[model samples]
Target chain A: MVAVATPPRGAKRKAKAPTAFGGYWRRNQLKLAPWLFLAPGAFFFALYVVAPILQSFQISLYEWDGLGTREYVGLRNYEELWWDDAFWTALRNNVVWLVLYLLAIPGGLFIALFLNQTVRGIRIYKSLFFFPFVISQVVVGLVFAWFYDPTFGLFNEILGVFGLGPVAVLGDPDYVTYGIIAAGLWPQTAYCMILYLTGLNAVDPEQIEAGRLDGAKGWRMLWYVVLPQLRPATFIAFVVTIIGALRSFDLVSVMTAGGPFGESRVLAYYMFEVALSEYGFRMGYGAAIAVVLFAIMMIYIAFFLTKMYRDEKGV
Target chain B: MPSITKTRLLAFAAATMLAGAAMPAIAQDEPLTGELRIFLDTSNPAPRAAMEGMIARFQEMHPDLDIETTIIDREAYKTQLRNFLSANAPDVATWHAGNRMAPYVEAGLLEDVSDLWDEEVSRDLASTKGSMTIDGKQWGVPYTYYQWGVYYREDLFEQYGIAEPATWDEFKAACQTLLDNDVKCVSIGTKFLWTAAGWFDYVNLRTNGYEFHMDLTAGRVPWTDERVRQTFANWRELIDMGAYIDNHTSYSWQEALPFMVQGDAAMYLMGNFVVAPLREAGLTDDQIGFFQFPSIDADLPMAEEAPTDTFHIPAQAQNKEAARAFLRYVVDAENQSIINAELGQLPVNSQATIEDDEFLNAGFEMLSSAQGLSQFFDRDAPAEMAKAGMEGFQEFMVRPDNLDAILERLERVRQRVY
Candidate 1:
C-alpha cells in the first residue's frame, strides 16, 4: 500500500511525525475544542470565585486586623461565633427570611393569573406591576423605609385614616426583620411573576383542552395540566427565591443598617459589620462569618446541582 | 529574536522606573515631587467646596507637587477607610480624634506626627494634640471640632414659658411641662445609631464628669458600674417623661430636623454643623437657641461633646514628605479658619476666628465655658464598644425595661473588647 501512503502523488505532500504537537492537536481538535472554549471562563471563575472562597476559609482560622499582622488561631473565630448573640440573631433572621421568602412563588402565581387575561390597557397594568423589579433593590428599600416610617410616613397616614395605629415597623425589634423582608418581597414577587408568565405562555393548549373536556375547568385544570407543564418555571422561581432570601443584604442594609439593636441583621450584613464597619478590622472574624454563610449556601448549592444532574440524566 | 529583545526592554523599563528605589533612605532627603493623595469625606456641599479651595491653594503654592483625592460620603467612609488604609493608601486622610484613632494607631496604620507639634502648636492647642495622642505620641492633627448641645425653638420655649434649665430636676420639670403642653420635648434619630450616643455622652459627661466619661469610653470602667448605671438612670428620667419624639429610631438626625422646626418637637441635641442645615430648613437665627446640656450632679464639672475632625498621614503612604507638608499647611490657623468659615463649623486652632453667627457664637461660648470637652461618645469609645453602647442606648430609648439586658450585653463587649 506504499503508493505515497495510498494517496494520489499529485498532491504536494511530506511525511509528518505523529508525535508532533500540531499533528496531535489537529487529530484531537473536535474533542478538545469544547474544553478549550471553556478554559477562559474556568480560569476567571477559579480566580474570582474559587480562590476567594478558599482564601476566606484560610482567613477564618486567623486573628488578623487587616492592617496588622495575622495570627493563626485555628477555629477560634468560629468558636467565638458559637456564643455570639448577633450571629444567632442573624442566623435566625436568615431562616425567617428563607421561610417567608417562598411566599413570592405563590404570590407571583396569584398575580400572574389575575393579570394574564386580555383586557384594554392590561399591558400598561402589567408594566406597572413589573415596575418594582425594573427599579433597583436600593431604591425599593428606601421607598419601603419611608412607607414604614412611624409618624410621617404614608403607612402611618393610612393607619391614621382608619384610627388604628402609627406602628414603627423598623424601630420595634419584633417587627424590624419582618418589615425588611416584606420590602424584599416586593421586587422578588415581580421577578417570579415574569418567570411564571413566560412559562404560562408556553403551556400546551391541547392539554388544557383535554383537561377542560374531562370536567376540569378552573383549579382542577390548573393543577392537573397547567401546573405540571410549568415545572421548569416553578423550579427556577424556587432556586432564585431561596438564593435571594439567603443573600438578602441590600434591602436590609439600605432599610435598617441592621439597627434598632441589630435585630434585622442577616449573616451577610453582620459579616460586613464585623469586618469592615466602623467597628475595628476584625477581618478574621468576618471571614469566619462568611465561611459559615458559605457552608450554609453550599448545602443548597449541592442540592441544586444534584437535582440538575439527575434531571439531565432523566432527559 | 524580537520577543527576547522585548522582554529585555521590559526589564530595563522596570529598572529605570525603580531607579530611585535603590537608596530608599536617601530618597526621603530628595525634594518632594511625587503624588500626594488625600482621601477625605467631602460629601457635604460646604465642606466639599472648602476642600476644593484648600486643594487649589496647595496646588498653587507648590507647582512641583502633585495631589490626588478620593472623596466619599461620611457614612460609607467609616467602612471604606479601613479597606483603603491597609493597602494603596492615600498620603493623608481624614479621621476622628480620641479613641476613634486608637485602633489605627495601635495597628501602626497611622504615622506618628509628634515632630510636627512644635512650640506654637503646643502653646495654643495642646489639648487637641493630647486627644490625638496615643501612648504620649501624637498620631494626627485636629483641624476642626464643634460643640454639641440642645438646639431648641426659642419661640416654642417662650410659649411654654420654659427657661434654659441648668439642673437635672429643672430639666425634668421642663420636659414634663413640654409634654403636658402637648409639645414633644426632645427629638432624636437613632437610625444611624450615633445620634443616641450623643445623648448618652451628654448625660454621662454631665452626671459623672469628663474624667469618668473618658474612663468609661476608654474601657477603664465596666458598663455594670454604679456610676454608669446612674448615667442611664438620669437618662431614664427624660424617657419617663416621654421627652423624645415618638419613633425616633426610624429617622436620621437630618430627617428628625422637621420635628424641631414644625414645633412638634421642641429641642434637638446636635453638633453645630447642623445649623446650616437648620437654616436651610427655614429656621432663622432668631428662632433657634443653643444651651448646654443640664447638669445632673452639682459636684460634677461641665463637659461638652466636641467631636473633632482630624487628618493623619497613613504609615503605608508613598509620599511622606508632601503629606507632612500638606498636614502642616492645612492646619495653619488661617487655613483652618478659611475651611471652617465655609464649613460653618469651629476651627480647632484657638487662634482661628469662627464666623459671626448666632449658633456659632453660642457654640463657641458654650465650649469655652466648659471645664472639659469630650469627642462625643461614639468617637471616644472604640468602634466595637461604641456600636454596642449606641445600640443599647437605642434599645433603652425604645424599651427602657431592657436596660438590664442591654447593660449586661455592653459589659460583655467591654470585657471582650478591652
Candidate 2:
C-alpha cells in the first residue's frame, strides 16, 4: 500500500460495487434470466400444448371411448395396422403428397421472380397473387370443386370452347387426388412466392456486382449468388410446405372426402375417418396411424435440425 | 426519510384489499344467475331454424339465464360432441338413438331421462315411447321419427306402365320396365356411404325378421349365414339387371333428388327427408310418392327403417331441472306441431295434427302403418361393423364382379365384432 500497490501488471482499477439485489441478478443472470423471461410462456405451453401432446400419447396406448376405463391394448393397435390396406394406401398417398408438394417451391420461386420488378402496377399484381392465400381453404376448395365440375364448371366450359369433351376430374379415382393436390398448390404456391419476394429484397447488391464481374449471369448468377443468399427463405418455405402437405385435410375433405372409393385418402384425413368419422371410433388404431405419420415427420425434422445445428456452429 | 410515506402506502393497500373482499358478498346477495350452453348438429336448414326459434323462446321464458348455443355441421358433430362431453358437456344436446347412443350411455355420460319420459310423455301414443326406450329405460325423448323406403316419381312409373312393386320379383320387373323406357331405375348416392347402407338394411331385414336383423346387427349372427348370403344374392340380381344409376358414387343424396324429381330416375330409396329437397325442386306431392321397400321373402314380415331424432340431458348437467322442464314442454302437442309444421317431419305424438303439407301427411301415414320399424343400418349396427358393411355394399354396387370377396370381407368384419 505504501508503494502504491506497485501497479501490478495487467491489473485494473476497482469500479463501484452494485446494489445487493442487482449484484445477485448479475451474478446468476445467465442461468436465471432466460427462465424469468420464459416462465409465463412456458407455464401456458406446458398447460395447453405440451400436456395435451403427452396426454394424447398416453391415450394412444389405451382402448378408450373418451370415457370409461381405458384398457391398455399395448401393441394390438399397431398389429391391426399390419393388415390395414387402407392405412397403407393412405401412407403411400402421403408420400406422394410430400414429394409432389415440393413442386410448389420452384413454382412459387418462378412466380416470385416474375413478379419481383419495378414495373407499373406490380404492387397490384402482387396483391392479386396473394388473394388466394387470404381466403379460407374451405372456400378455395369449394371454388375449385365448382371449377372442376364436369358438366358446367369453368374448366370444362373452357375445354368446351376448344371442342374437347367434358372430363370428370373429381369423379375419376385416378385423377381425383391430383385434382385436390392442384387445388392445394394454388395457395401454397402463393405463400412461397411471397416468401421468395421478401428474400429477394434482402439480397446483397454488392455480392451481385461481384458475381457479374465474375461473368456470372442468368442461371449461373441465380445458382451461385441469389439462391445461396435465399437459403433462410427456402428453409422456411420447405418447412411450411412439408407441414402443409402432411396436414392436407381440408381440401381433400371438402372436395372429395377421401372418396371415389377412398382413392384420395392421405394420412391426415384417413386417420380422422378411422378415429372419429361415422365409420368407427378406433381411437387406438387412429393413434397408431398418427404415430407412424409422426415418425415419418421426425425423420425430416431430424435432417432439418442437423442442418440448422451445423449452420449455427458456423460450419 | 421515506418511512412516513411507506406507512401511508401500506394503509391504502389494506383499504383496497378490504373492498375487494367485500365485493363478492354484495353481488351474491343480489341474484343467482349464470350461462346455459347447448350444441346442435345443423345439417338441414329447417330443423336448425326450428331449434333456434325454440331457443329464443326458452331465452324469453328465462330472461335471467344467459343461453349460448353452438351449431356444427354433421361431419364435425361427432368429434366436437365427444370433445365437449369429455371436457365440459352442454346441458342438453341432440343425438341419434339406438346403437349410436350406446357408447355414451354405457359410459354414464347421458342423464337418465326415464323419470321425465314417464311423468311427461303421454303413453297413449304407440310410436312416441318405443323409439326412445333402450333396455326398458328411456335415455332420450324423441321429437321426430322418419320412415325410409323407395321414393318414386309417380309420373315416371305411370309413363313406364309400372306400379309400385309389392315383392322382390315385381320390383325387378319394374326396374326392367324403367330401363327399357330409357329411365334409370334407381338413383343412389353411394358417395355418402350411409345411402348404400339403406339398401343393405332393407335387403337383410326383408330376408330376415326384425329379431334376426337385431341379432345380426348386435353381432349375434354370423355374416356367412344363408340368410346373409341370400340377401347378397337378391342384391346381385338387381345389380345384374342394371337397376341402379350409373356413377352413383359421384352423386350425393341432394344431387340425386333432381334425377327423381325430373322423372329421369324411376325410384329413389331414401328417408322421408328427401321430400324437402323434392319440393324445393318444384315437384308437387302428387308427382313424388312413397312406397314401402319390396319384400325379399314372402313369408317374413316387412320391417322398414325408421330413424328417430332425440334429445338427451347430460349426466353432469348443472341445470338438470331446467333441461327436464324444456324437454317436457317441447314434447307437448303445441311444440310438436310447431316442429312438424316447420321441419316436415312425422310427429312422435299421435295426437299432434298433421299439417296440411301433403309430404308430411304421407310421411305420417307411412310411419304410422308400417308393420315393424328398425333403426337405420348404420345406427342399428355397431359403428365398426356398419362401416365395413357399408363399404362392402358400395364396392359391390360399383363392381358386381367382386361380390364373393366383398361378402367374405363383410363376414370377416362381422366375425371380429362378435
How much does each candidate deviate from the true structure in C-alpha RMSD?
A: 5.5, 8.0
TM-score of 2: 0.85
Docking class of 1: medium
Question: What does candidate 1's lDDT look like per residue over B154-174, in tens digits?
Answer: 888898899998888888888
Overall local distance difference test of candidate 1 = 0.86
**Quality of model 2 by C-alpha lDDT:** 0.79
Candidate No. with top DockQ? 1
Question: Model 2: runs farther than 4 Å from truth?
Answer: A1-53, A159-166, A202-232, A278-280, B1-38, B49-72, B119-122, B125-131, B240-243, B355-369, B408-412, B415-418
Residue pairs with backbone atoms closer than 3 Å in model 1 (clashes): none
The Cα error of candidate 2 at residue B193, in Å, is: 2.0
Model 1 C-alpha lDDT per residue in residues A1-315, reported as the tens digit of each score: 586577656333334444577678878999999999999999999999999999999999999878778999999898889988889999999999999999999999889878988999989999888999999999999999989888778988999999988899988889999999889999999999999988889999888888888888788777888899999999999999999999999998899999878999999999988887777478999999999999999999999999999999999
lDDT, candidates in the order shown: 0.86, 0.79
C-alpha lDDT (0 to 100) for residue A52 of candidate 1: 98
Model 2 over residues B205-303: C-alpha lDDT tens digits? Answer: 888878888888888887778888888888889888888876577677877666777677878988877878788889887788788888878988666
